[model samples]
Target: MAKINWKPGNMLYPLPAVLVSCGNNKDNYNIITIAWTGTICTNPPMTYISVRPNRYSYNIIKETKEFVINLTCENLVKAVDYCGVKSGKDINKFSEMNLTIEKATKIDAPLIAESPVNIECIVKDIVKLGSHDMFIAEVVAVNADDQYIDKNNKFHLDKSNPICYSHGTYFSLGKKLGTFGYSVAKKPKKKYRKK
Candidate 1:
């Protein structure tokens, strides 16, 4: 395979597309779709979402210091795309996108009730990095919808039909979130690579 260096840019493929809801109250509540987000630490449950300084929700999150990361699925893809492009200042995202806001258990920010899982975060620090400022937050609470509680989905959490973004397009990874030891389990006697 021949590989050529194009340009210095964000070449990381397949990132979780999340709807981050922010604001202190119902009047100021807003949602912004973000792909530049993920878990950074495990001990205290930390995560970060990078947002453009000019975004509508940027100041809301900055002042409130709280937000909810709503994991997106196939059904929410249209809304995700719309939310990312449309400014919350011009329109009510929750009403326009038809998303219900639920009160977070441990945080002041409201969560998307339709989402499979909502991670409530409290902003620990803010690092201004070029065009986007990274909101480094600590996960205070996580709410998983009761619909996901099933013995049948013990191994695969694919029922939600999760969606991810690569470059400019959103893609769905079908089934099997992880199956690490499948090969080893099948051929135990064969010596394999570094574990």
Candidate 2:
């Protein structure tokens, strides 16, 4: 089949749509929905989120050098889209979205109580890249809701039904294939019982 030529653009789709919570103390807390976020390093657990300077939460995170990457679930899709399109300056997102702010362990920024996982972060560096600035942060702490944990203590993040952003649309993650190292992993050997 022949394909039509399309203009060169950012066609990289299906990125985690997370609500990054920022600011210190109760009075200054804010949230900014971000799709331009990804794990940068595995050794020290580092991640980056790119935000435009005009975003209200951008300045707060820049000035404070800290934020929480709250993983969005299926239920959080509405708030995630709302937080991205609406400015924190014009509205109290927590109140408007009916989201609860819970106390974080290591940072002053509040965690989204509704989120199954919250990754507390401290900004290590900022790179200015035209329309957006990338915040490189060290993951300080990760909090997960106990409900998603199984009796075996296996955290079933997949059951949370995480949401992702792609080409201006939000989508829920679907299905699971093999896990890490499965391709090269050795198969279990079977033991023959004495007949």
* Clash number by candidate, in order: 0, 0
Runs off by more than 4 Å, candidate 1: 152-156, 183-195
Q: For residue 79, give model 2's deviation from the true position in Å.
A: 0.5
Cα lDDT for residue 92, candidate 2: 89
How do the residues 74-191 of candidate 1 rate in per-residue lDDT, one tens digit apiece? 9999999999999999999999989998999998899999889999999999999999999999999988877767776453337788899998999987656547777657554776
Candidate 2 C-alpha lDDT tens digits along 30-147: 9999999999999899999999998899889999999999999999999999999999988889999999999999989999999999999999999999999999999999999999
- Show where candidate 2 strays beyond 4 Å: 3-5, 187-195
Error of 2 at 54 (Å): 0.7
Can you give the TM-score per candidate against the true fold?
0.90, 0.92
Candidate 2: global Cα-lDDT?
A: 0.93
Question: How many collisions between residues are there in candidate 1?
Answer: 0
lDDT at position 123, candidate 2: 97
Model 1 compared with the native: what TM-score?
0.90
How much does candidate 2 score in TM-score?
A: 0.92
